[model samples]
Target: MTVDPELLIHRDADDLAFSVAARMITAITDAQSTGGVAEVVLTGGRVAARIYRAVAESPARVEVDWQRVEFWWGDERFLPPGNPERNETQARDALLAHVDVDPARVHPMPADTGQSAEAAADAYATELAATISALNDEKRRAVPAFDVLMLGVGPDGHVASLFPGYPQLAVTDVSAVAVHDSPKPPPTRVSLTLPALDRSREVWFVVSGDDKADAVATALAEGDVPAARPKGRNRTLWLLDEAAASKLT
Candidate 1:
């Protein structure tokens, strides 16, 4: 059930981070209240790092049973595990490490281990399918219906490494795919395809800075950008700071 996207403008990046942190905690708690584990797909960016730190430092952090929340990444750099550039490493240092989360439930994309990017993507897809199969009786999708799927819009209007005009944007058969020769640095990555990202109850786009304002506005206007493609099942939220929302009418 695709729905209209909602715009939430914050005073600044700091305010945006704290607000998102609170909202994330509440969302996780609400999902758990329904007697199911909270499945969250995390994104990586400067703004996201701030949000994670805010979550770790929030006084209401205890409201969520971190161990019951499953953490997954929307995309990752194909660097080795524990590399500072890896989203998993940043997330762990900023939030997951501080919380009492079950390490077994934190699913990061496969790192470069002498395997081809395509092979790594396939491995992650298999892991995602296995996890969903264990939790759901209906075999409808390879990925679970995530409680909250967070994403960061790149300056080029990319989300989860799905760059504008990239061929991967048209991929629908797989939950995950390998991205080669990325427009951004490192050139290689593994990302959840649009089908996988759209399998979520809430899709939150956490963006900040004036550099992203044009992309944000373009996406909200339904322009031909990758960021405009993925819509949440229940809600689509564009959580932006003032600078990021400045270009929006």
Candidate 2:
């Protein structure tokens, strides 16, 4: 059952990030209120980093039990663990460091370990499988339908390192993959494939800036782009600011 994407426009980047932080708090508290821990897959970008900071500063953040929430990344730059450019590092610095999240539940994609990218991907795959198994006792699957999966729409219509027209977008067998020679900087990365990313109850694309306007329009249009193909099981959301939504009709 494919659900159409829901477009949400905020005044600007700051407002969009703040709104997303509030929504995230609501989702987490709602799940916790139902006596279940919520799992969220986070993306990286300027807007995402801002969202994290907003979350950390939001007074409503205390409504959710941070320790009960599980954090995962949609993709990560395969750099050293503490590299400032790494998504995990940015996330921690922006929000996680201030939150009381359990260290055990924070699952970051593998970084430099003197192993091949494929080997690192395999290691993360194993870890994800175990996490899903422990989370879903009945299904014991490789992936879990996470409560919320946030993605940052790139200027090139890419999501989770899945570039437009890239062969990695054709992948279906694995939940995660190792990207090499990426068109963007820091060529190597670890990314959750569409299959894994799509395994979410709600998927949110947070985008900002006029530079991403065309890409946002393309994604919202009935297109075959990889960014448009991945949707959530229950809901697909496009959270954009004025600039990013400018090109959308």
Candidate 3:
């Protein structure tokens, strides 16, 4: 069966956060009942952080098998640990710090690799292969389809580290790659390639703000053919606030 992405928009950021928290807990519990573990890939942004905070505060979060949930970043800022711009650091402050998850399983791309971006990219690819190998299933070697993926849409129709007008945005092989000259800021980052994204069973594009309305409409209306837009290649749901969805017909 094909997994379809769902967009559940809320009135504002707080409601959006709470809704995501409730669904994440529910999804984890449901998955855990059928299987022993639940793996989740996460993204970083104000919206994503809100979901993390909500998860941290929710009572059900403590009940889930924290030890059994292996965490992975959908994309990470290639900055030193503790850097304010790093997704891992943001996640830590937002929720990970409060959870009892296994430190070893929290797969935050190591930014301290003593090498150039190209070398670091290669190292991260190797790391992904090893992690997936350890977590593979009978049908798939390395990275059984993820239970869910929480993503943040950029103003320029980018998700994860796939920036528009860049060749990395069109990458297929190698699940992860190091990004340079990201239009946003802190240009350097490590992101999951399109193939890696296919690992998710459900992908959510949690978006807010008026500035993103144009990009939001473009991705959703442009269709899922990669030729149209970067976000179009996968099963994606555009969850937008009033301002962001205002222009949609």
Candidate 4:
């Protein structure tokens, strides 16, 4: 385990992405060496977008057996297909679309926005349950263990849909959840619950901005304050650029 959030302070966005790309490459190789296959859960945000693009451009990324990998989303905007705000759409354009991973393995959150968030939540859970059942050796309802999970920390200390002061963050029973009234923009969305997210062997929270500096300090200050500073946890990482790390004390 890392003593701190694996701080990687870079001078600019490009340097940040390169560092993230390298770390991600290491994660992919580690997963492959251990399980012969890798299952990754991806997140969204400005920092993540850069990392996604960098991974796409990385020459070393081709070393992984893309065909043997599966992809999942941590959160998704409840928007129409191809909507600019949708995380899935962004990932498709940024990374997945360029990769050779089988189309069947890319699991985006259910896009039943026309339906109620509750209904969409159930449907998303069902889809993941079916996939997990098929993938697990012990006939589980959830994926045995996600190889890696990448996330973006909202300034409000939200990770995925586990937003601060939100009731859903305390959700202990469900693996996936649907969110309404998001404190951020585009109110309706779906997300993996904290339980679901922590199932991953490795979790990464990448942030890069001056605005996020305070949150970074809180999250790393040593307390189980996911709602206050979602960065607290084990087997997790916070990859930050110099701007985001500036206020850490």
- Which candidate has the highest lDDT of all? 1
Give me the overall lDDT of model 4.
Answer: 0.76
TM-score for model 1? 0.97
- lDDT, candidate 1, 195-232, per-residue tens: 99999999999999999999999999999899999999
Global Cα RMSD, each model: 1.8, 1.7, 2.9, 2.9
- Estimate every model's Cα lDDT from 0 to 1: 0.93, 0.88, 0.74, 0.76
Sort the predicted structures by lDDT, highest score first.
Answer: 1, 2, 4, 3
Candidate numbers sorted by TM-score from highest down? 1, 2, 4, 3
Residue pairs clashing, model 3:
132-142
Which wins on TM-score, candidate 1 or candidate 4? Answer: 1
Please give, for residues 149-196, the per-residue lDDT of candidate 3 as tens digits: 777777777878887777886788787888888787787878888777
Question: In candidate 4, what residue range of length 10 has the lowest lDDT sum?
Answer: 224-233
Greater lDDT among 2 and 4 belongs to: 2
As a TM-score, model 3 comes out at 0.89
Candidate 1 residues lying further than 4 Å off, grouped into runs, are 138-143
Candidate 4 similarity to native, TM-score: 0.89
lDDT of 4 by residue, 1-249 (tens): 223446556886678878988888788888778556677888888877888899888898888788877889888888888887889888899998888888888888877547777777777778877777677854342436677888877676677887777788878887777788987789988888877776776677777888888777777775444623332234667678888889887
